[model samples]
Target: MPQATVMERTPFIKPNPASTQAAAVSDGSRIGFENVSVTYGALTVLHSFTLTVNPGEIVALIGPSGSGKTTALRAVAGFVRPSSGRILIGDRDVTNLAPYDRKIGMVVQNYALFPHMRVDENVAFGLRAHGASEDLIRSRVPECLSMVGMSAYAKRYPRELSGGQQQRVAIARALAPRPQVLLLDEPLSALDAQIRRSMLDELAKLHRDLPNLTVLYVTHDQSEALTLANHIGIMRDGRLQAFGDSKALFRHPPNRFAAEFLGRANLLPVSGLKPADEGMAQVRFGGIALSARNHHGLADGSDCLICIRPHDFRFSRSAAEPNSVSGTVLSVQWQGDVHNITLNIGGEALRMSCPPMTNPPGLGETVSVHFNPAEVTLVPEDGARG
Candidate 1:
């Protein structure tokens, strides 16, 4: 068995005396799941998941449905005990602790606000339940609401507020007790696109204000994960498929699932993988030879997939350009800022994005697309998931 590597807990920083909001922020907690697994009867929902969330860092767990993101969050909250392994919070083993003892706050998708309660009472619920003094609850309730910019609406009922406002109240309620960690489960999923964007900005501002607040955000929205999280954990089929810094993970995915899941990827089937100069390889696809950066030790003539992002391809008129391929435009869809162009190369369909300011090729027009060798990624053919 591999030895468990424990991370050193970060020391708590004192709040700045000049900022009143800093007094309401709790010392961030380091969370770790060591070889954890969750099961219900004969079904295993999470398989040997291991991850460590650094103190004061935001980590987002993202995947499709049944990927065990919520299950992992529940384990951290002590709502679901791991069938094996251990969970830790700031050096304390909390795997067997009750939910209320974990010292973590959670805001769910539906906002979960009490319909009959005013915003102030809703925010005070946690503190009151924790047996806080009446004076402390009164002070903490307004402080929390103020932190979320909801102090003006403290007397309004949940039904009287908009979706975004209610969500702000819910977040205030979660943070009222000053828990060490905050778990958000699709908190912005119910809002419209515009509201969601605005709320994302609000959440970012909140993080800035509460610099010591550790967050574990769960969502299937890749854009949200990319926008908010410092680290991203990609889950699939009860396992953590990929985990690392968000930008690095998206740029250099380890497998096909991650490459496709993080963002758009054009998986071009290629063969004849041979080493070229400058850490590059020569690959042949559809009778056209292309150069790609080769990190994987692919044997000569081995079948593989060349992964490229749609934005990496540039429209060209010359077939003589390096890594150039000619294809006929099949369809064009204009997005608000860019145009999505579909092309038929040989018999395979490929998607590319072009700037709206530049007119894309018309349907049935033959055009050449050029890609740089540095932008190509080589992966084994079998790395693709079903």
Candidate 2:
């Protein structure tokens, strides 16, 4: 596990597991955005953002900075008013609601805990803000703290806690108010690698404990999204570029951006697109035939890019495979358990990975690499899918 990335360590986070679903409290607290668009003066920040987070589902919105992922989350929290359209929690419209009235809990990157407040007080703040009975706050504060495994730290102040502990307390505070929806905006971004890894598990457990708590998570970390979310929404330039079940979206990205942004990928230009048997399509890359899924049902003879993840490419000892291709080795990097390979395929750069190569091919040496047709998927060159 020394060199393992989050993706390598965790399976795609499943939708609410059976045990959690059975314990879930039914509330129709689904999160919805209907053509929600936000503008500041002349600049449009979010463009007609529309997506649904089902009750008990964790949906992550991910993208580069200024892509409106946070804007979309804030809109749901009632912090940023939409210039057009509406936002809803369950079936109740909350576009015009006050932040305190939205029944949405938000955890930010900074933790945002009151420095002078003890952990218990911080957890109690939300309930008080919502005008809960003192008895409710007393019981809820301890219950939420226990749920996050922070009941022992209830007497400690934020300054006395580590970053990871502070984040736990933050999450506890968010859950204290019995919110129908929780918005986590880069909640683990501030932690180091080790702590972030553990926090990811903590979050997954938290969702299981409170399965009815709908979540809209905004993050730039693809692995975190893939590890914690049942559904993922990839944003780009203030638009929802792609949204689907997490595993499906990663395996069949709708465009070049989604393909590259979701993971490390080699996009090779291909032409001569044609249908093959069993729902497959063929494209030619530098005179070499490549077959893959036609996710978009692209028209015949159209040009598009074939996306191959680094790990999907395997070194070929023989050219017996139908999907075999030759590449000139550019460089090979030994990164613990895996070999990172840079290759020249028809003059374009492609990257691949393999088990540690004890005697890696020398730079400029010709090498053969092959991939499964099922492992490769197509992305439209111009970012559109027909």
Candidate 3:
């Protein structure tokens, strides 16, 4: 776990539901968790969880299992009562509302479609539960199925379709009621890798089609989060470790845990920090005066870490990249399209990923990797101490 840093740069637009949901609709389409917490007996499962899912935006809560990401989703679904604080859909307080009262569409990992019912029937069930008219059910069911590209499978039973098809039906069922809020809990985890990738594309397309739909997506897969979410919240041990726009969070991680979890990061111990040109800062790393973005604003001469992605370390230098590190080639591996090289620099291991090279440094050979200062980011080394 890492010491937390508040990361949202812009205020999230709020949630809004259908006009029929007078009890749930307030202003816009958004979800707000106000210091919500959940505890069972002596153990706390969620700790003051708070975040906003803006209108038409997808926010993914990603972390290792048991980190309370699912618990946070359930709280919004009204399946878990918060021990304190409030939950709101739009401006309406939903903390005390029943699950049925919230105009929310939910898709879970298991696909939750009725095995005995046809795809069309499953999609109509939600509409019926809300007491919609027969005409509306007939039209909405087909529209939702079509939205998920499952219109052709309307008459097929859940067992008759493939895993991907079943998941599509589940999504259609969730979307049938025209809910403004969509909660997805690892919705693509049941499918194979190929199907999962396809579903990610489908989901992105679905969101584009329904621009006003706000989504709260929970997953343990970081890649899924990065591919689908506009903003990502990294959680650990029942707390949010970091949150920001996907690219900014990945490009400039705030702490050690976030840096390593969101993507590949090569962190090196550094101190003697001092301001450099423009927004960059300088630090000392094994006699190398490295320059990087001091994201945490760590003071001068303070111990911190600089994070460099493996792909950012270049095999050759240019005029723009003045920082270079020399090391002994410990391992060189050709991983299909790229080469993964492990270097030993002053007893510390530094990894570099480069495009397929015609000539790679052999084992025990001295080599140097150059990186631009703009590609380096400083992170607070307050967590991930292993």
Candidate 4:
């Protein structure tokens, strides 16, 4: 990996105890957007969105293009002023502050390195802009580069380095100012898959080294958000759909958009649902009665969708088993460690992931798939927020 190569060039710098204490004395690095909104004339880009990012936490905002994830990040950076509400960093209001005055660092998707400048000069740009002394800039430049494991390439120009190396320079430049918060706007989107994965590890390590640095990352990639974020905020059509810990949100999404966005979900339409024993629901799908854990306020005879992850289904030997559905295997795809089996059950296609070591039914073969009731989640059919 490029970061590993850079790490080999210099010893990792540990944060000094005294410096840590000084940095934490007034640690107001937490970020909050209270009922914020942004508009461009008649079109609203961000709705009345509100979320809080804890100090030193990495919060990834994820959604499709035009979903307002980037707009929220830009609001925090002070590039686009909010049309309503306020933005807070720690306890101070930064809603009206200029981008540079906000003391925030941003790394854009393109890396945005100056082509003509050497890496060291690029890393020194932020410090110089903030009017740091010459000696301080000199000392900080090498330290930032070293943190990113790019100190040895400080003399090289952007054109002379590979894509991964250039990204490291961009990150080093952002960190040089020692801003209270870091905003990453799809910083790894330009790289290839392997390089992107390597850089993700590097960013996680960088966060560990800088414990007080709060990060608000924006990306449309679900895997990136799941892997790097402590909390994830899902957005669509300018509205904040859901916000919670990455794992919890993925496991128990509040709405259909969130369930479908975060990962692959089998959203099966169910009817004739009634309250059963122990906070469970009995629902009928394709004339078969099945039990599922009920958390949503589903009334008797109400129709809803049942959400079950692909991995939650297992291959059953017979259709007589509880919560079993008989189907024909439409396709079987080998995905390295597991096989993804697509089954056509009563005209509906359901996907299930099976371990490669286990025997998955061949294509065009009849099969029975089973899932435990506890693994199922019920979502409202209308999907209207109550």
Candidate 5:
């Protein structure tokens, strides 16, 4: 086995600790998995998936359990091989390369540091194996430790450190060699909320410092993907559902599943479409005419589903208005910053989130609800559900 080695310090101050200058095979740092499919016997884990990680970009793969998010990360790490397709790092074809040969840094949620070693020793483990000069290892370990804000805990053992601290050590260890790509598999899932928040900040700072490093981050947490990733690839049942900028995906999801899966949504089944003024359409939602943004793909008098985010709906007085509905308040509950109000409309329960309003309506009372036409989306009703 090839030993991991730490880098030699040249004593240069980082203008931005979030950027990296690591280069990959082709010309710069890029990871591409084209038509990548992995199968185990008769079962296929990944299917004809194509993804690219541009240099210095952070892309997150998010999905539910058994969605193959981790499988994709492992494929890039060389921990698993594709039955077909190509895996390229920079300009190099590394489809068959060993994991250690790829020079990629990997951090899992477990923070798998060596139990017997101190923080500094664990960070230096890779460098020592790669036969780095003792002087280089000695000087680089502290630098890497400081990079993760774990320099003060160098003397502590893995058992002595908190989950977040141990995770930082793991990150420092992976980064010791200055790899071209960093793959994180739910790295914050194990930490408490406060620590996770801090670690997220540190990770974001690191991204700003490493300008040339490509990152492939896998997580099931939507908030993590939304906050940390420049782009996101949503996965479901071992297939890519949608991939694009985080804002774009959240603002205009391609389908109902994408909308509901990415965040809380009120997906209302529809029956027809009619022209409404002002670049909007009067969508015939079952027994209701709702004004919505124009959805070119939804033909006139065609059945579809309207996806409205819970946060987009607002409560109003019980009165008929365009793009509004009247319903009996089913229940209301306090959720710290907001109130989750459930409304019974046409025998269906619709949930909406609103800021804690003064003198909220009582349950069993009829109330009016309004949603912005621009925020209401139209998707094919038949195939909207998975």
Candidate 6:
């Protein structure tokens, strides 16, 4: 038995019952993990985790490498068994079920296609293994290939196709079985940026066409999760930090890890010992006063931290508005469509990304930054406030 790695302890938030139930009932597929924990030898890869995926729903598992996103998918796919608890597919307990008996289709990053088999034959392999009639395999293989726009290249072997085409074949092979759940493990990571973009479009179309298929997509790409998944599960270490619709989690992350991981955020530490009316408090940062929403109901003489997104920070040469911070421009990088500016403030580097570089400020110049209080999140410095 080996020791559990440091990345296996990240926390995750389960979706509320209303959201989970609504998503499950609306979609045709249902997946649920109840108090699930998995250990390999002596290393516990997943904690007591629970999550639900509705039918026809695409849930993107986003996290750092070794955070157990793939482990969770494998648990659901029956590749890895939970040491305790149950996995339910469409309300049936499938935790102890065999991988082949689980009836799930998997497409991984490597696009593992049979080297000797032609594209059509690769797509038909699963159906044939499942003992589908020859007529059904013939009818379904072409249709699956056509769905991924690989019908014309059905006769091409895996080695003859480009990386993207081979991935399409892999997807075709996975979809040919039409399993209750589709598990995609970083399926676009093998392709170049351009091909990845094109495949995303094709995947989006596939989602629209087959609205009844439950998709459990695993990726480390944040932008891909944002673009493809209606619901997102943010994992850290091995725990799920947050799970909700893309919009809700992005708009309001429950913790500092989630706020920073889901996207770019500017964290500002603040402290004060006084409280205002109705459990609300005014904390000062960099000699400027700011009001906190105080969802944690802070008492008098309690310290709190503040978080503001980089985009939320607006810049102006003249300091005329409230909630302004003064900083010296460190360096600037032109990213074609936007300018990423690093500013030096209070011994910490603050980054600001502004739209399409036009008349940007010069480096070494001092600038005033403004941010809305509403856009700011109030978190306690010691993991107390959200």
Q: Model 1: per-residue lDDT, tens digit, 1-386?
A: 33222223211122222323322333339899999988877788889999999988899999999999999998887767788889988888998876766778888899988899999988877776666777877898888888888889988999999999999998998887787899999999999999999999999989998878899999989999999999999999889998999988877677788888888888888998889888789999978999898766777789888888889889876777789998899999998899888889878788898789466678999988999888777877775463
Off by over 4 Å in 3: 1-27, 317-321
1-386, model 6: which lDDT tens digit per residue? Answer: 33322233211112222221112123336889898887877678888888999888999999988888998998877767788878898867988776766667788899988899999999987777666777878899999999999999988899999999999998988877667788999999989999999999999999998888889999988889998998999887678988999977776666777777888877777777356565456787767777655655655556656667778778855666657778899998988988888888776688888896667889899888877666666665554322
lDDT of 2 at 279: 75
- Report the Cα lDDT for candidate 4: 0.83
Per-residue lDDT over 137-255 for candidate 4, one digit per residue giving the tens place of the 0 to 100 score: 87888998998889899899999998888999999988886778889999999999999999999999999998878999999899999999999999989999889989888877777
The weakest ten consecutive residues by lDDT in model 3 span 5-14
lDDT, candidate 5, 234-259, per-residue tens: 99877898898998788777776688
Error of 4 at 29 (Å): 1.3
Across residues 358-384, which tens digit of lDDT does each residue of candidate 3 receive? Answer: 988899998777888887889887896
Give the range where candidate 1 is weakest over 10 consecutive residues by summed lDDT: 4-13
Q: How big is the positional error of residue 260 in model 5, measured in Å on the Cα after superposition? A: 1.4
Write one digit per residue (lDDT tens) for candidate 2, span 123-242. 887666655677777888889999898999999999999999999999998877666788999999999999999999999999998877889999999999999999999998899999
Scored by Cα lDDT, where does model 1 land?
Answer: 0.83
Structural similarity to truth (TM-score) of each candidate: 0.89, 0.91, 0.91, 0.89, 0.89, 0.86
Candidate 1: misplaced stretches above 4 Å? 1-28, 295-301
lDDT (C-alpha) at residue 13 in model 6: 16
What TM-score does candidate 4 reach? 0.89
| Better-scoring candidate (TM-score), 1 or 2 | 2
Positional deviation of residue 206's Cα in model 4 after best superposition, in angstroms:
1.2
The true-structure Cα RMSD of candidate 3 reads 6.2
